[model samples]
Target: MEKKTNAEVQVNMHEEMRRAFSLLSGKWKLEIMWLLNQRLYRFGELRKEIPGITQHMLTAQLRELEADGLVLRTVFAEVPPRVEYEITQKARGLGPTMEALTAWWSEYGQSVPEKPSMRGRKAKAASSKLG
Candidate 1:
């Protein structure tokens, strides 16, 4: 086997990074995945959980995730019918990435200076949508 040239390796890395970023490019997709990691949720619940997210955007994001195989959508057959979305095993594999992000935020938060003028702390962003 032969090693690839540095230029070829760099190109491959760039392409790989682009592909990964493209998958999570949407504003709320990462939030949705993080929420689903905690527990499964229905459509209505998801909408209520994600602040500033319109029903139209939520629906579109969920469908996109489902198509990408990151979100698992299950629909029950009944009179009214029920649908729920959960993170698939593939999505669950993102746990380390999420944990690292949380860790980084913790360190970053600590680096901020405390000032009386700052007032109250910032609020948590709305929980990610489940479905």
Candidate 2:
């Protein structure tokens, strides 16, 4: 094998990481993966768990995940034809990464104050004016 330059190696690494991220790109894919990582869920159950995702969007995201090796979709032969989704072993490999993200978020969240609610601000103003 021919030796590669440092710059060429860095570019290859960057492209590999980009390709990995591209597989998981989308507003809802990560969210869906997180939920599926925990347990199996049917189409309706997944829709209910992930708020703000429409039926069309859920279907599309699931399809994309299934296309990738990260998610597994199973269909059962039954009266109603049940279908369920679960994360593949490949996705489970991301557990450590997810834990690291959670840790980072926990540490980062402590320093940043949450935004005050608009309703609370309005109520405070009204009370001050009345007093």
Candidate 3:
């Protein structure tokens, strides 16, 4: 068997990164995962925990997470159906990575310059046009 070239290894790594991002992308997926990591939550509970997320969006994000094998959804058989969401073992494995990112963000975020506001940029552009 031939050893993989550096270019081939880089390409493979890039593809894997893309796949990882696809699973974790979107505004609420990471937040939802963070919450679920703490403990199991019902659909309504999750919605309440994540302020400003619509029920439709929460459901959609949970479904995507479930499909990705990072989250497990359990439905209980009873008079009133009880559904709960929990992070899977695969997702639990990401705990260390998440912790490292949080630590890095605390240090890195302070060093980064604040982004200029879009409204400020637009006002500057308008003033320049008027001049």
Candidate 4:
């Protein structure tokens, strides 16, 4: 077997990290996964759970996750068609890593100052312009 040089190893690692991020990166994807980590949710339920997410955005994000094999979407035929979303085993495998990341954020976020409110900033700007 040929030994990989340090540069080769670094390149491989970088590619792997990129792939992982590509699978998980998005405004709503991680939040969707976090919710599904608890239990299966109906489309409407998920929308309610995630505030400010549009129905269209949720559908798109869920489709992306389903395509990536992180989330499973099931449809049931009935009087009223029902659909549910749940994290796949592949995603469950990420539970520990997600937990660690969440824990780190909990600690780190406390030490960090709160971000300025975008809504407040926008209102202030508008008032300044009017004034």
TM-score of each: 0.74, 0.75, 0.73, 0.77
Clashes per candidate (backbone, < 3 Å): 0, 0, 0, 0
The local distance difference test score of model 2 is 0.84
Candidate 1, residues 13-130, lDDT tens digits: the string is 7788998888888978988988998899998898778777877889999999999989999999977999999999998998899889989989897888776533223447798888
TM for candidate 1 is 0.74
After TM-score superposition, what is the CA distance of residue 106 in candidate 3 from its true location, in Å? 4.2
Best by TM-score: 4
By TM-score, rank the candidates, best first. 4, 2, 1, 3
Stretches of candidate 2 off by over 4 Å are 1-11, 110-131
| Tens digit per residue, CA lDDT, model 3, 1-131 | 99998876675877889999999998789999988888999999998888777788899999999999999999999769999999999999988877887899898989989985432112223434453
Candidate 4 TM-score over all chains jointly: 0.77
lDDT of 2 at 34: 80
- Candidate number that wins on TM-score, 1 or 4: 4
Candidate 1 residue 56 C-alpha distance from true site, Å: 1.0
The number of residue pairs in model 1 that clash at the backbone is 0
Off by over 4 Å in 3: 1-11, 105-131
Q: Provide the lDDT at 48 for model 2.
A: 81
Candidate 2 residue-wise lDDT, 74-98, digit = tens: 9999989999999999999988887
The per-prediction CA RMSD against the true structure, in angstroms, equals 9.2, 8.5, 9.8, 6.7
